[model samples]
Target chain A: MAGEREQPAEPLTLRRVAASHAAARVVVSASFEVAAGEIVGLAGPNGCGKSTLLRTVAGLHPCERGEVVLPRSRTPAGVARVALVPQGYAQSFWPWASLRSGIALAASGSGRGWYRSAAARAQSLRAELALDLDLGLRPYQCSGGMLQQAALLRALAAFASGPEVLLADEPFSALDVDVARRARAALRRFVRERGVRALVVLHDVESLVETCDRVLVIDGKPWSTDGASEGVSTARMVLNARLGSRRPDGDADAAAPTTSSFGDAMARVLGAGPHP
Target chain B: MTKGSAGRLALAAATFAAGLALWLALARSGWIGRTLLADPIDVARALAGAFDPAAPPGARVLVHAEATLVRALAGWVIALLVGMGCGVALGARAWAYVLGEPLFELARAVPPILAFPLLLVAFDFGEPAYVGTIVLGCVPIVAITVARGRLGASRERSELLAVFGVPRSVRALTAIMEVMPSCFLAARLALSTSLVIAVVTEMVFTPRSGIALGALAKEAQMSFETDVYFAVVVVVGLFGYAANVVLRAVERRLGLERSTST
Candidate 1:
């Protein structure tokens, strides 16, 4: 039943989106599609340009080659189709604007005259996350965790108005465990209800396994000085695995996986036993 | 006001009174001649005389005070607008900064007061020369401060705004709001500096009408009217303080803090 829903006729496509920073190609031609209501997890080593890939798709970072094709047509008002939850909580919001204002601004970015309604929705999302945040508090007044929740709420606010694609770069990195769980639940519900696609870059393999419908893992140092777009440099999906009920043990740190069982879970997500 | 602030205000008042008492005592002791240091009572009398409508035209302070105020305010407002625009442009564009910074540094290194003689020659030692002096004196500090504020703004937040496709007007508003605290501080600094430059210009240039606080101070000093000179000094200090208070009030009303706490 889940497989039928996962395989949508028209998925949101990225036809070889390639991005280079200065002389070095950071995201060397990544091509993938996230089906409707699908949460795709992008897992890789540090400096693999996971965030850069998301930014390229969002059209924030300049793409050296290729383009992203959204599944749905744009709204009549020409609102934004993609909402990005940036990696760092510190830079997610304007220091002068209160959390409520920040959320409203994000909402207003996608929809005209939606600030008031969006502010109300943000207030509710703060409550949903069980955050003890005064919506009136500015970004500097809030902690890293609270700012993370606010960032998520801002993205959710943008998504609430329409069927916008969500690209989250380590959304749960700054959040505590319980808050991360709640935020994940909120994200899932929003995606399910809105029928929008999401590509989440995550460092925690366990959460990626638990949250994503499908996982795409890239391996090796894909950057080179010679400007070659061959082999692993082009970021071909080395493994495309389906998520299953393959939970790692509680003893294992979610960040650092030591046991082979965790590796096996990753292998299960990757749909392979192991990679050399 | 909070109890702490109220206590602070009281302490400030007491400290001012103590300073006044010390000045009076030194003046009475004759350590400094009466011509050099006017007693508090005489200075108060001179203040009253200057404020009186019936006082002699040359001794009356209001006309000169108004001239000084108008020049200072005009120069300060012009400097603030021009400085903020230049600062934003320099900060937003790296190429502009690379080109403009060395020129700015060269101008900044020279004392602003020294420009008075050159400006007097250019603008003929009148209101234009004085206003030009004030502008030259204050613009660099305001521009540098505002540029620093704009540069220090969060780059990620800017990218976020771009991602949402926020309108250019909204983005500009956000940018201005981000830099407002620094701008307000720069305004205060600009105001005080403009005030000093205006008075110094008046004293040095000495307009034909002799219609400025600095002109009056110079006259009082030349005529040995020590009391009026002291009173003029006190009034200038009060104006500076009042200008700062007004800036603070406006900042509070706009919900901007004085410091860049963020």
Candidate 2:
């Protein structure tokens, strides 16, 4: 007889979460839940609080009215449950710290020992991401694309020590097309291997469709927009349309019906097609 | 060595030779009075005499150099501590930065020499007045440079730390570590200013001991020993150069400049 797999209880839950910067609201009120082993893409135009929403979920930004509940693992007392790959390589890591030092510090912060094995993990992840750079190099010495890869590696190192959810804000925005494709594949593989849930904020629509299990759209700046419109329900509708009409490997086949279907779905939610 | 480095070394030597040649020509020409502008040979002799213990009673050049160095170094260390402390405090809090900025700006503009009279009255021509002059000259530059560097630290980096639940103490320490490169660069500037202020303070407010190169220069001027005055000035220039060389080595050893873009 085959053994039944156990499912995790709500890995991440956001209830009526609202964030603002001194009266100018960003994420008005967003309520959503991400199940374990799920990849959710947050799509929106520039300045529409996609980054803000991710930050709020990551607990970096304080939610004014609502609550963000992150599921805790059994051990590791003080480590955070959510890991973030912040946007922009230049803004992500300390310029003075070598790639190894920064990742070691992050791993140590996540309740893992800063040991040789941790460094070996980081070295392998750097290779897996096709970074092809020495771990001893500082962020300043690396090119923009290389730095972005390093940032992803650091996020993975943090995630290695049992962070339930990964919050990635524009992780691949700085990469070239070929590198982006490789990064997307690596991200998918890494997340699957760890069985971690992720909420990725992306402007590139194709990668979103390729990598994410479900897609969520936030219309016009969430915080300042007057009426408290339906947030999670609208995302649910898009997700349903995306899943019901499309196959998981639709992006691989150029003529797959789901590609056009996904594009059309995005057109309605994003006020434009995938290119936007 | 690489060709570029070799060329650079040659060019530097050439420039120094050219400057010395020009100085010699001017001194030999006697266009200016010899008493006012000493010849290079006489200046060299005076420099040698300065280090000789038996040259004169109460006129050993080492004594003046030591006194000036002690005062300037004390002032520089104080500036380093105060500047970094105030800069971290101001950078950490937005309100404190806003409140402190204008006061720092105003204080920075007032020349240290102009404050000497006030310092003299406050400390009565003592060591306090001399050290205060050096601090006033140096502290503002160091503090402002450090504060700006601290403030310009990337918010995304801070958010990265926050996401991993790094403790606030670690975050603060990391912030300081990042700012150190710029701080050392500022220290070079502060050090030069402290040297200038130390010498000027010694010159303007004559100490009762009269044990400073600037005081020795004043005495040399009165006695018409123009070569001795010029030698003392050369020593002061060399002191500044030595301090800068030390700072550059430190920056290299720490790899601070190597790691930073600017």
Candidate 3:
């Protein structure tokens, strides 16, 4: 009941996953599943270990207990490849590289088949998403929204090289309403088209319910529990939004519940007393 | 030039003029004796004489500058490369950083100029000592700063690189790119310090049969030829300033001039 243990299609799986930061056990035994074609939303209060969980699944951080069971069967590289778009876009990007070069860097693969195709794919994604951007500018030259867009572009470019599990940490929090809508649309289209999964962290509950197929709510111990032992995660899959059968064009139409209904559901889950 | 640049230039001119006025007042009032502070006009004449072409070649500022530049540049360039190489190598692994830190600290404990006497004894008070001292003075800073550059990059950026699985060569290049600001700082510090160290080396060792700028200043000062001493000082300052200008221009061309340090 903790996860879809019966399903074996090999979507990104974290079984008994525990992650920590700077010696403080943050994710205390988190178990969840992100199935193919799923745009799973991770929602939680601040310091609830959402980012740490994403980072651990992406193979960027160390896992204390339990294993992250990455799907290698469906990947182009015959191994799990994850692209993490972290919260700090500016710091992750190579300050010295131009936007075009940064995208190209992400597009690169070990072998020749999918390496350095960022320009073409970026052009196509840009057109599909209706994004207006200049690839010649550096990260510092771009605004916050622009940089976030660039970070998204880089992750997607990496995804193009193979079937990548997209782990984005508040990837579009800085974008304006219009851009955010279009970007979400493009992300949904990409996941559905390629049958890949994405685990996107979102602080906005409305966006979480309206966009994600399933929402995983992260809950954790109080900050004072520094020595909280090996029991790592307290995350749960609480909501299945009637938000989509989700639209690929940012519309809240198909099988969509009322805005008030979705808001109440999110409120109930978020306002729940505490994870026992 | 832009308005800001023009304003800066005007301010620099005003400051220079003020310094000249203060120097003239001090000389006239005999507060700082002429033996200690040469008359500006006399210093200008001495400078002109050093470059007059009619003057003996041995006294020519060009000859001394050329000799010192070659010696100092040889050591500086070598040290820069060595430092960068060490930094890149050590920065690639945390264990390497831990292992190399002690050596870097030891190198830092002794300033490069202080090594001159040891080098002087080792090289029998010759040209090799100056070269050796200049290299010693600069390597530790360049290496330590370059090594630390890799550590300062945000984890998000590093995760991107890792997820993409960029080639080893690209990773090396990224390592280099992350540290450009530190590299520039290292370069600027090394360039400015090497010249001063070179001057000190010459004054202490006084090349037996060659043109050494610091030796000329030392000889002038010992004999109370304040004008000539000031002239050499001006030339040494000019050399340091020009090197900085050249370095700044290179960094600007690379578009790394405003890059943030680690």
Worst-scoring 10-residue span by lDDT in model 1 chain A = A249-258
**Top-DockQ structure, candidate number:** 2
Better of 2 and 3 by DockQ: 2
List, residue by residue over A234-274, the lDDT tens digit for candidate 3. Answer: 32223323343233443332221212333345646433222
lDDT of 1 by residue, A1-276 (tens): 222343234677887677765556766666778887778887767776777778888777788777888765456665436777888656767665778888787666555567788887777766765666688988778888888878877877754553468888888888788878877776776676566788999888656855677666655335321234445534333345555435331111122121234334556554443323
User: In CAPRI terms, where does candidate 3 land?
Assistant: acceptable
lDDT of candidate 3 over B1-262, digit per residue (tens)? 7897689779968987998899878878888888999998888888777678778877776678778877788888988999888877777678999999899979978867777888889998778889888888888878888788755545566567776666677766666666787788788888877888888888887886568888888888899999888888878887888788788768766767646621
List where candidate 1 sits over 4 angstroms from the true fold. Answer: A1-9, A77-80, A110-112, A159-163, A223-239, A247-276, B1-38, B223-225
True contacts kept of each: 0.44, 0.58, 0.48
lDDT of 1 at A94: 69
- CAPRI grade, predicted model 1: medium
Give fnat (model 2).
0.58
Off by over 4 Å in 3: A1-10, A73-76, A110-116, A159-163, A222-276, B1-33, B39-44, B52-54, B89-113
Cα shift from native, residue A73, model 1 (Å): 3.2
**B262 Cα displacement, candidate 2 (Å):** 7.4
lDDT of 2 by residue, B66-91 (tens): 89889999999999888878777776
Tell me candidate 3's TM-score on chain B: 0.88
lDDT of 2 by residue, A1-276 (tens): 101334345667778777765466767677677777677788756776778778788877778877888876644573336677887556676666788887766665543355455577788777867766688987777788777777778878764444568888888888888888888887876666565788899877677766776666544554322233544322211222232234344332121112234445565543332321
